[model samples]
Target: MAISKPAVPPRIPCQQCPLRPRPSFRDFTEDELDFVASFKVAETPAEPGMAIMVEGERNPSLYTVLSGWGFRYKILEDGRRQILNYVLPGDMIGLQGNVMKEMQHSVEALTRMTLCTFERERFPQLFRSQPTLAFDITWIAAREESMLDEHLLSVGRRSAYERAAYLLAFLDARAQAAVASHTELRQLPLTQQHVADTLGLSLVHTNKTLRKLMDQGLVRWLDRGCEIIDAAGLYRAAEWRPPKEGARPFI
Candidate 1:
């Protein structure tokens, strides 16, 4: 008799999953929640590296990152690629589609992903009908712009050590915001390839820099995630400073 392989598990719906427990629903009023529910659909499952939207394509949907990391990238005619950004849970990925209709870059899943997709027609309607959501999206876009500006600094001026240090500090801050503790660091889902693409550094150099961080007693990369051992030391190496103005708030 031939041996049979085990069946692959079916993907879990976002509602059923424990990871994304509707963090934003309470932020909406009952009427607002109803309106959003009418426009939003159940989660769309995506495989790792699946391209959700391609450059120059006529995009008709805007997505919320229900649970996963995604890469936004643009390609040059000569085939060189630059990763524009990474979007995490609760982040909006395709808001540009709402206005531009034609996407300037492609969005790909960095892991097995679930996205809450909304029709372009209904998405903009929410902005007009729901002023709160409009401001929320506006703030989100502005935050993305600020992050892009920081990336420009990292690529243009920061050395490899500074680049790696900056990323560590930034990741630590993100985890603190969500979990409310600077001592606790979130698991970094990024691989060396992802870091290299995002930071405009070669993969070999990125790996070397990460190892140097470990040697310097700034961070320890365990099996699950990186532990930030010395937060102040890391920030000092990166020349990081808090914004003079407050960071743009996003829901």
Candidate 2:
């Protein structure tokens, strides 16, 4: 039996999604949209464990996550992989390459990931045509860099419980933004291995850490997703505070 491919959703919804929630079209006149739309194309679907880009490959293009989650990681010479971070909906994966010229780490789908790719060369024209889109894209890249910096702090300075607490707090904020609620949040779709790699913990330690959080009434797991049972407590445990500017800065 031949397997059927999933139908690609029309791009119009991308212009309308609550996540996009900005004046994207205003950045480009109709002429520019029409011109750029011609080059827009559906990408091949990436399976849950597939690598989108290897560490040393030429950066292919800027990727807009149309669906699913992905993460980046760097493997040590001894072959241990330390996951860099997670990319969720409305996130772009290759913006760093815009400056670096090549990928420094591998990016892989953490779920059945769908994306829309814009080539590097076409990006200049696209940005020139849609200044707002360019700004949004730049803002997203800076946000990702800030997140990585925060993750570095968590791994470098936080204890196991603190690390787990920080992950819970972060996900609660992200899910509330992306999926609509923190209390109702569940179904994170991330496995223990993913959590371990992401938190820079051994699998055993991650498991223990999660159980401790559950025991402390700080977080709960249900329906394959985690819910913050005590947001204030979790934040305190993680030593988390919204930055003074209300957002972390890229540096």
Candidate 3:
């Protein structure tokens, strides 16, 4: 897995950020936007399967997903990997690196991705000067924690079929919120192996669960992805309802 500095930095002026105007995303004031624009260091690009940040490394920067998909995960001594969560567009990555001296988990790209880098040292200044931005950062962290809690509940207590249904509905809702374009909602970039790791099931078990969902017309497996056929059906099967969320800030 390789990480490279963008040869030609992608100009992502905060004022023109595509996510800022979306109802799912909060708008930034000119002053706040200007601060963020200046705070941004550069664009970093990662190819599919590249490790953006490694476990136990002391990374100097934090990042926001400018585009594409990635995931947070941890590997055990036995090399068993557990995918903690998906990182979609506008999601923050490496916030833990700022609080802890070393990263406790790793982040890897699932698709070709671009990330907006921010020097970790400037985070304190941001908090002191931009209270609203600081609050948004806290909100993002809380949201991540909430999702983790739900994932824990699903893996620990739910039946395999219910777990599979919850995961599909969760990802479908998150992916739909992240993209402005409706066409992107039809498919998610996930494989059976990713599903297995996330759901804490063996690959065989994951496939069986997914096949059942497909048979019920809840979802369909693509060559390298999954398509949600009936999101409501999946939610019903899981007995889950997504919490209402406010416009989220894109840091």
Candidate 4:
């Protein structure tokens, strides 16, 4: 319902996709590149807080985030929402809806976002002709599942301090990978409410835990987001380390 039909932004051809050139991503072959260019139908923008996809809806289009951030979530009848995971540029969305009959969860933009839309009907053709790109799509889904696995660990077993530390450290590492420049560090673009929702903690508890980290010089809470001041310290506090990922595939 939140999808808007404003004038399209100047589309970036798949051959010149900025995210493709990032070291974190693997380069596509010429054939794969050409297929992607055709697969993409248009470029669209979603404003902050817009609902990109809703539960139980069948979406005809898929999207790859061109810029900015979003989060996947599910809501209950009583209005309780659970934040599933945050999405970054180059991440594919609407796949769950495309593959299944309807969306099981919802997606909402956390910041102004640019997204490359793909025709859903052509998705099967890629799998039939381009096995490698099909594998890339599978890999992307697996990676998302892996993130959910870790979140499960945090919420099910980790303590409040450990949860806060692990969440920030994990997000910082993910942001670094998604960004084009490794040297240009940025904030997590998250508020305490987002943190609490994601971690399954109360807002007051989330604030208290964040304050504790700030006191230890592990992280800083800005007005709109969070900054990891000492990633190593946070890792130590959380007793966790990020995985050493090689160049990952994206679609």
Candidate 5:
């Protein structure tokens, strides 16, 4: 938690939040919005590479990402890290921390990020007063689990080409939805090591596989990241078909 910056008033209030009008996000009722506005404790910032939460730490607050990107990972005793999932706008983190004695994974920001913080103790109030919102939160957890299931399958069963293609396509699709209304498509901010850790592949293997993708024009590597050049092509190569989804809930 490197948010040593001074506290400041929230620039974007819940009512005028930029993400609300985007087609990717489910709409909130006036009452629900009001409650959410009150639910927020503060808006906090996390710089790139900052640890938002660490494994085995007890976090006092939960977070809803308001902007930018982050990833969840778990490190083994020997220092090897396995990325669990990518976090984007509207994703709620620290829920597990609230439920368990300590967090099982660590989260690190990939870009300068803003997060809406909520008191962990206030979670019970939401469940008691807002059944609908509680269900929405449950749905988010279920969806994350489903995504992890697919990743487990990929790591265990898929080929190198298939894994690389699927990973890029998946990130592209999710980024498109998460960054709604942005004029340009959001380029993924991922390094080869990031993909390797996520896919359970060696760094060299990840490089060769991504090179194959670049050769075929499916993706292009940038300074410390890569951009999805042809999403449909990558999807076809991976033989992955993600289920279509409409606007989904975000707290």
Candidate 6:
């Protein structure tokens, strides 16, 4: 399916960005903030189930998640789909598309989302004029790569129970970092089908495994989402430790 474009773009000032000034996010210099403000061209809102970007498309813009959730996935020739990663608020999207010729995977919004759009062609200018911002961009890319590597390990070696625990814990940590909130429960806007596709399990198996986690008090299933209940327990169950992260830049 073709991706949908925003009907109307919203104008958001960089100085007033919600992600800025949070303990988990880095503060930009006056000049750097002004540059990013100019760099941003538009803000687009996507509804649930809409494709923000499609596989193999040469899109002209890069995006940063301003709010809400999305997932990246690739479809095989046989029409089997594998989810690669989840995109949360404060995460950058389409960096690969900007650096390469086309997008390697598709990103679909799991909830109502707002994305900040930047011109791809001007990224080089940011690198040339603002070395710090450039470094932050590279840092974001490396962080994404590290997450993918961990996910690979989880899928390849971990048992279904361990994998489910690790995935939930990972998502909870990311949500906490993005929002800088220590709330006991965070909404995960995903279905059992998404969980199944991500973990390479059948829907029935996914449901059964999730029930086990629910019984253990690690997570609670909701009508349209899941709530992370015991993050520490999940970490222990998965034998995983979250990496320490410094302030992250949004753009």
- Candidate 3 or 2, higher TM-score: 3
TM-scores, each model vs. reference: 0.78, 0.79, 0.94, 0.94, 0.94, 0.93
Lowest summed lDDT window (length 10), candidate 5: 177-186
lDDT of 4 at 13: 91
Q: Can you list the residue pairs that collide in candidate 3? A: none
RMSD for all candidates, in order, please.
4.8, 4.4, 3.6, 3.8, 3.4, 4.3
Candidate 2 structure quality by residue, lDDT tens digits, 1-251: 78977576545433333444432212444444465455455555689889988887787576767668788899999978788887776567777787776788899997897776667877777577767556656777767778889989889998888888888778666655554533454456677677788888899989888999889988776654566778788888887776433331110
| Tens digit per residue, CA lDDT, model 3, 1-251 | 68978569658787788777777888788899999999999888889999999999999998999899999999999999999999999999999998888999999999999898999999999999999999999999999999999999989999888889889888888887887567645788989999999999999999998999999998889999998888788889878786778878878
Q: What ranges in model 3 sit over 4 Å off?
A: 1-6
Over 47-133, each residue of candidate 6 has an lDDT whose tens digit, in order, gives 999999999999999899988999999999998999999999889999998767989999999999999989889998999999999
Q: Write the per-residue lDDT of candidate 4 for residues 11-51, one digit (tens) a residue.
A: 78999999988888998899999999988888989999999
Q: Comparing 1 and 4 by lDDT, which wins? A: 4
Candidate 2: residue pairs that collide: 187-225
Please report, in order, the local distance difference test score of every candidate based on alpha carbons.
0.71, 0.70, 0.89, 0.88, 0.88, 0.88
Candidate 1 lDDT by residue in tens digits, 128-246: 78898677778788878887899888888989888888876876665454334333544566677777777788889988999999898888777534677888888887777764434
Clashes of 4: 0
Q: What's the C-alpha lDDT at position 171 in model 5?
A: 85
| Ten-residue region with minimum lDDT total, candidate 6 | 179-188
Off by over 4 Å in 4: 1-6, 180-184
Q: What is the lDDT of residue 35 in candidate 6?
A: 95
* Prediction 3 TM-score vs. true: 0.94
Q: Write the per-residue lDDT of candidate 5 for residues 77-131, one digit (tens) a residue.
A: 9989999999999898888986789999999999999999999899899999999
